[model samples]
Target chain A: MATDAPRRGAAIGWYVLLSALSLIVLFPVWMTIARALSDGSATLFARTPSVLPYSPIQWDAFSRAFTEGGLGRPLLVSGLVTLIIVAAQTATAVGAAYAFAFLEFPFKRIVMVLCAATLLLPIEVTLIANIQTLQEVGLVSPSQGFGEAIGALTLPFLAQAFGIFLIRQGFLGIPKDLRDAAQLDGYSDLGFLRRVAVPVTRPVIGSFVLIAFLSAYNQYVWPRFSVKTNRWDTVQLALRRFGLDNPDQLNLGFAAAIIAALPVLVLLLVFQKQLIRGLTAGAVK
Target chain B: MGKRRNVRQWALAYALLLPSLVVFAVFAYLPLYRLVHFSLYQQSSRLGGGERYVGFGAVWDVLSGERFLQGTWITIKFLIFTVPAGIALGVLLAMAAHRRLKGIKIFQTIFSSTVASSVAVSSVVFLTLVNEQIGLLRNVSWLSLKSPNSALFAAALSSVWQNLGLTFVIVLAALQTVPEELLEAAHLDGYGAVRRFFRVVVPLISPALFFLAIVLVVYGFQAYAQIELITGGGPLRSTETLLYRITKLQKNTDLQVGASMSLGLFGLTFLVALVQFRLLERRVTYGN
Candidate 1:
């Protein structure tokens, strides 16, 4: 709305400021990728090249990290774990949210309060007893076994209160008349859940899936508690191994770092809306 | 027939709740019940061998001891370093990108890019820069890893950056929800852009800011991966917050100690959450 001179100057100023801030935010990531692609180890003094990757980029870093640093194995484990968790949690949310939304059960109100209470009990607080239970049940091995590692990782997160709470919000929005109408059509409880209810809550289920997947994939602390070495490392745990390794593999660790972060970056870009929706669900009210 | 059907419906509902009930029972209630239960009993072995009943003494020791207080002070320092900056930057980013300037979507994506990176990914990225021997950013005041103070600062830097995306997205969404006409009205009333943002926009977005505070506080105390990755609780255990201390205790030494410390952390988190709910949550202004 203004004349050309000040407006153009203001726009240029904004661009400068925004780009500088963006560069600051993106700098670490950029540096990691830059390191991953370079020819040599970047010592603090003078060996470090200009900010971008050096010429003749080291593509072997990615492949080496994939094979040597054992990045591929953890990636597979993380994927499988994320898949199992997302499916299991979503199904559990459907059942629990269904009961809370529609069906009558004993101590329903008390159960609802307890479900809310679960939000307060973070995984860190419950680490000791949970690990004990896992050990006693032989789900985790002190010597580093996948049986225990997988069990310990997947079980604690099988049902999240946030997932149940989110689905219940969706279910509450379903009209009573719709359920009644389904009943008139001889839709049994399970039938309505399978058909109408599930379809109607697609957005909620989608958000739950993304959230659960991220939660399972991004686990760092639990993996340490579950497995001693890199044998059962999730990508997050594996990243630590790569971060601290000897000189040659150190470069691959940088590559592996980007590799570990790629899927999440893709997820954030693809499901930005759902991710935001899931994140802000608590914030809104 | 109706009575029989009602009973069947109740049975069906109960059956439906079984998986969630079992999961919650095993994961939530059992751990919760056992956190206190085990804290009361002293385990002789790291893997829970001998049991000596210690009652509330462990919890008391954990709360009143120097280690726990040291961790508490570090946790508070982390909060001070991260949360206000987190909220303020969130608001700033939202303000900058909330405007419909040229190519704003690109800037928006750039502003929110950190959301994609998790604690591990971000820590790895930060560690590459802050390593004492080889760090690109080692010379900086806070990112240096040799000293405990700067090492903890390095960990805090990662946490703050990692949280930026979530905070920015939440505040941006809150900004977008603020009606445009309100800002235009303020503009007509002679309020400058900065004044309008602080006076008009902030009150409306206080709910989002309040929510960010709660999440950041939770994130502050519960942060583990960054500390573990960046400094490994470092030079003098300076970077060790409560969660790091508890996990280290569990992994390295006795189960009872970790359990007791976990209980202390739980209590603190609850007290802080309750205080925030009581103190700051009321000032949050909801919209029409």
Candidate 2:
């Protein structure tokens, strides 16, 4: 609409800046993929080897890195943990949000304040005591192994304070009339939440779930502290150890990074709109 | 229908809330309880011991150390560097994009995409880009990468760049709240772009800037991955922030010292945040 006359100078300035930033941002990612394709030609000291895949691409690096990095076990573990967290957080946040937004309750304001206050407590602060508590409960018994340890790491993060708050903000936008009518139609509170609030706020829920999942998957500190065995190292830990500690295995490290990053990249591509909306939603509030 | 329905509705509400309450109580509130209790005692659970009641002595011990004081100083320095830099860059980049230009969508996406970067990934990318041997920045430094001047500056520079996206998005959203008519009027009043920006646009969007500053301050304190990956808080602990020192101390002897230092660091962060929020509240205009 504003294109009647091209603002050539302003447009050029914007273009140059954007292109340069993109190049800076894209270079590392390009290097990873290119290295993976080039039989590790673009490893740590390899420089920008080649943008294109070699004629006989060494696809073995992917499989090698996957198993060699002990990624298969953790991938399954992280995937399962991520799913449980997403489902649990989404269900919990939506339920809590519905209660806060629509239902009248005693101490609603107090509960809301409690929810908001939880946002400021850093997990690292409580992590030591939390680990001790988990040990007492047998959830973190070393004998139970890495898979169970992954679950322990995910449990504390299962009910996110910010997710509940974000969902509450979204649910507040739903007019009282729809909810009131739904209640009058002989539906229970839970039923009304399911039929009315959930359907209305599906997009926000989807976005929050994705955000929560990605956040859980990308978690570094919690897993690093909680997971006792390297066998249970999540993708992020594997990437860090490989990329930093073992420089000689640079090609494999690059391959590992590419593998680790693939899921996030795919998630971004798939839910670009919702991801942007959910992230910016915090600032908008 | 009315009376019976109201009772059922309230019951259902409690039922819906039960799951989250259970999880939070077990995981969050329980851990919080343990933390408070642990802070009061002299012994860690790892070492089964005859318990000694120290009361608030641990908190006292935490705040009384030179290490803790140095940590507070470094953390404050980091906050000072990152928060203002993040907000300013965010605003500048947003302004640069605010002009009615072709391909604005591309710019917005490119800038905002960094919001998705985990601290770990951001650190890796930055470390690789600035590695003394292979980093893109290796060749640009007049001083060798090993030089304290280049090393510390480069580490800070990478963190600032990585965070620019988050700051940009917040400021850009704030910028959208500024009315176009006000800008047009300022232009008609013969104010140039810079004058109009400082006079009209800035005041309107100061709230977002303030919020972003607080967020960045919290992030700066929580800066672990960046320091760990790029410099390992090293080249002689010159780049070591409070967290890095705490972690290192923990790995070495003196878990008590490390825990105490962490608590002290947390206390300082809380105090500064409270003070900043109060001061910034005066300048930030939230609404029309």
Candidate 3:
């Protein structure tokens, strides 16, 4: 690590410059938190509220955002959807990656190509068709409680190509001799996967989960077209609704945005490296 | 015995792979097939006009029309506004944080904090900042209602802010990999900090920079939520990018038009990716 050691005299200048940049970057978040806590939703727009919470920290707005603003349900929905997405993606990706890495099957090359090709046609490119498929499967207009929730939110993203690719690379990078040795030691294929492959590639799988979970949680477009009713609103859609419905309720809106961002903030704090690695995997060699 | 063992291996591999293959087939491959198939039809089933086969005419209709050309221009303008600004700021932040000074970790955390904010969250934050009547900036002397371009700039401002964290983290990571001895060698050669950076540091980090450029361009094309949220694709539809137009068509129930527009957007995305791979990828200096 080339830690660019600071010179004694010039350190002050670097500190000042870096501080200014930090303030600039963190300003929006500060503003958001301030408005969220400001009294009466009093800090509408014109006046810049203190970055620190202003007088009478609007505990009401937080409760209102949770209750009146129809936020809690979406939080639950987002949680459920994200949980399923992460679990399903990780499991399927592990299985497929293992198959690709160690097993011989007919159409193996074609299956590999198919996996790679999914990268090119991101859901944005196939929006209408996916919606149509969703409708055909009766997901778009489901009648009821759990089925509708699962159908619209979790079904579309049960698998991810990126996860498969990331974990496949993980499996392949393990030396062939190790797998052969495992087999010679009387480990079945599934046994080898459980005892060796998974534990060794846990970091790669961990990063993939982080990426997939974040993407699922942050989904905006799909929820818009899929969840026709507020009963199934994801956090992203509900936040947009708050903005649209109460653009003037600046405090409440920022409060909701802050609330929505909290989990991600905690996650990023804990797994910053994993998130970065997951995000930049495609860009790096 | 060999035949039976091979059969068993194939069955096990396929059984393990079935769930993922099925999901991809349904969600990824099936939709793509439909995208092409429905794009050929003359009219959407929604409109209740008797189906007339168009044989790609609908696609031609969407792409040839003025709507899509203007959309392309808006998307490109957004790219121009954000990409270079994002790169410049990213590099500056990366350099500033790369120092080994005391308490630098706090600065690095602040720089990367926006990565936690999703597109919708950031858009909401900016909507308040840029609101026309009660906006924080509304009373600023120069930026009144008459300022036509301010909203677009505001949208871009939010985008640039959100991008800061991603770019900073990536560039900073890349910067760490630049060999220290190389910088020392350049210093011994009497190259100033700026010259050393341009001659050696920049070349080494070009791969990271190139990656940012491609991702930013793709993001520019696909941008929607911010426009839809803050601007609603207007003060005058000025902020509507290519994806916005496609989404608008979808919303309005113009299925045929939306499908064609989707295809056009896909093509545009493909073309942009192809161009970057050809132009920038060739020049990228991957460090050993």
DockQ (model 2, Cα): 0.39
TM-score top scorer:
1
Instruction: Let me know the TM-score candidate 1 reaches against the reference structure.
Output: 0.95
C-alpha lDDT (0 to 100) for residue A134 of candidate 1: 82
Segments in model 2 whose C-alpha atoms lie over 4 Å from true places:
A1-6, A27-64, A141-147, A243-248, B1-10, B44-46, B139-153, B245-259
Which scores better on lDDT, 1 or 3? 1
Looking at model 2, the pairs that clash are none
**Candidate 1 C-alpha lDDT tens digits along A100-184:** 9887767889988988898898887888778878877777775757766777778877787888889989999999899899999
Candidate 3 residue lDDT tens string, A175-270: 889998998999998999999999999889998989888889987877777776778888888886654335345567778888898898899899
What level of docking quality does candidate 1 show?
A: medium
Against the native chain B, each candidate's TM-score is 0.94, 0.85, 0.91
Tens digit of lDDT per residue, candidate 1, span B1-288? 988888998888778778877888888889888888777877765444467888886778877889888888888888898999899888888787787688988888888888878888888888667877666777787677888878888888888898889898999888888889999999999999889988998898898899999999998988998888888888888888888887767542366677788888888999999999889867878766
Q: Which one wins on DockQ? A: 1
Winner on TM-score between 1 and 3 is 1
- Badly placed stretches (over 4 Å) of model 3 are A1-6, A39-57, A142-145, A244-249, B44-50, B139-148, B251-253
Q: Which is the winner by DockQ between candidate 2 and candidate 3? A: 3
lDDT of 1 at A8: 89
For candidate 3, lDDT tens digit of each residue in B1-288?
Answer: 999989998999999889988888888888877777767765534545555677776678778988888888888888888899999999999999997878988898888888888888888887546656445665554333324465566777778888888898889888888889999999999999899999999999999899899888877776777778777777677777878887666532466677787888888888988998899877788767
For each candidate in the order shown, give its overall lDDT on alpha carbons: 0.82, 0.69, 0.79
Residue ranges of candidate 1 with Cα displaced over 4 Å: A1-9, A40-50, A54-57, A243-245, B45-49, B251-253
